[model samples]
Target: MSNLSKLESQSIFLLREAYRTFRRIGMPWSMGKDSNVLLWLAQKAFCGRIPFPVLHIDTTYEFPEMLEFRAWAQKHYGLQLIVKINEEAIARGVGYETHDPVTVTHELKTVALQQALAEYQWDALITGIRRDEDPTRAKERYFSPRSSEGEWNYKDQPPEFWNQFALPPKGAGGHVRVQPLLDWTEYDVWLYIRREKIPIPPLYFARNGKRFRSIGCRPITHPVPSTASTVDEIIAELYSTRTPERAGRAQDHHERNAMQKLRAKGFL
Candidate 1:
């Protein structure tokens, strides 16, 4: 099999495993390239039907195009989509200007997700986090468990070499996170998107000469200068550029361990 096929096979295997191991399994769909790719993979794994619910934590600040695309995909696939919003944070004026970017991240994303997970009682959350995306995410596993309160214990993790994984024992009181895309890189994601012809938000394509390298809330995300207008051009740009995949995301730079802090507290 080709490299892409191998990756697809592994992701499909994990998706199936996650469904079998957890009573309540859900996937976090960010409507970004990576997560969307995972969504396509999930469909393939379940024979064109996703077996678990898909959660989208709408901070109410995502790009407008992202919301449009979310609605489109939901209808396209007949998805069991759960739209989550942090109404309390927005009502309290938790934003980039009123609060520190990190604080906003915690309130709008981390805390909101904690509340949703606790109430939903999903035993496993399948997210689209990639190891190469950020330093904090680099410490993740293909199947990592979190505390009942949704706190991540990154310092202590099980080894996942040779395809072996350690799912937290049943009734151990916490849910495991299934990261099928942990091993994929930005280049890999683009290649997979191109190969599979997946639908994605248009913000990634250059408008004039800028495009979003990473997508998040509109308040904290920025577009990088790029001339890439098509998927092939984006793939070529990824091959030639030295910039980090999330270079335009402001939250990563405002605090030294922003992503780590947010992820530890259950931010997507």
Candidate 2:
């Protein structure tokens, strides 16, 4: 098998494993390339129908294009989407424009996700986080467990030897984060999207010589200089680009350990 084929198979297998292992499972879709690929893989794994609901934690500050794409993709893929928002935080005037990045991210994202978990009580949540995306994410296991309070103790993770995985115990009052795309890279994600002909948000492509490599809230995410207007051009650009994938994320620049702090508090 080719490299893409191998990666596809392994990811499909992991998706199946997650379904078999967890009593209740949901996927978090970010409307980004990696999550789009993950959604496609889940469809392929389950014969074109996802067995569980898909959750999207809205911060009320996302780009308008992202929200439009979300609606389109949900209809196109027949997704059972559950949209959650931190109404209390929004009511209290918590926003990226007014509050600090760390505080706003925690309140809008982490707290919103926590509220969803508390209401849904899912056994597992399948996320599209890859190890190569960030330093803190590199330490994640395939079946990483969160505390009852939805905290991640990165230093105290269980071991995963060979292809074996360690699942969180039943009735732990917490959820296991199933990372099916942990081993895939940024380039690999683009390649898979091209191969699968998956649809992604158009914001990723360059417009007026700028494109968002990673997307978040509008106030916290910025675009980088690029001329890659198509997926083919994007793949070619990756071959020689030296820039980090998330260089445009303004929040990452706000603090040295901003992501680590947020991830520990259950930010996805």
The model with the greatest TM-score is: 2
lDDT of 1 by residue, 103-189 (tens): 988887778777778778888899999989988899998888788778888998888778787776534557888999988989899
Best by lDDT: 2
Q: What TM-score, to 2 decimals, does candidate 1 have?
A: 0.97
**What is the C-alpha local distance difference test score of each model?**
0.87, 0.90
Model 1: residues >4 Å from true position, as ranges? 170-173
What tens digits encode model 2's per-residue C-alpha lDDT throughout 1-268?
Answer: 9888988888898889889988888888888888899999999999999889999889988899999999999999999999999999999999866889889989988898889888988879999999999999999998899988789999988899896877756447888999989989999999988888899999999999999899988988889999999999999999999999989877777888999999999988
Model 2, residue 41: C-alpha shift (Å): 0.5
lDDT of 2 at 20: 91
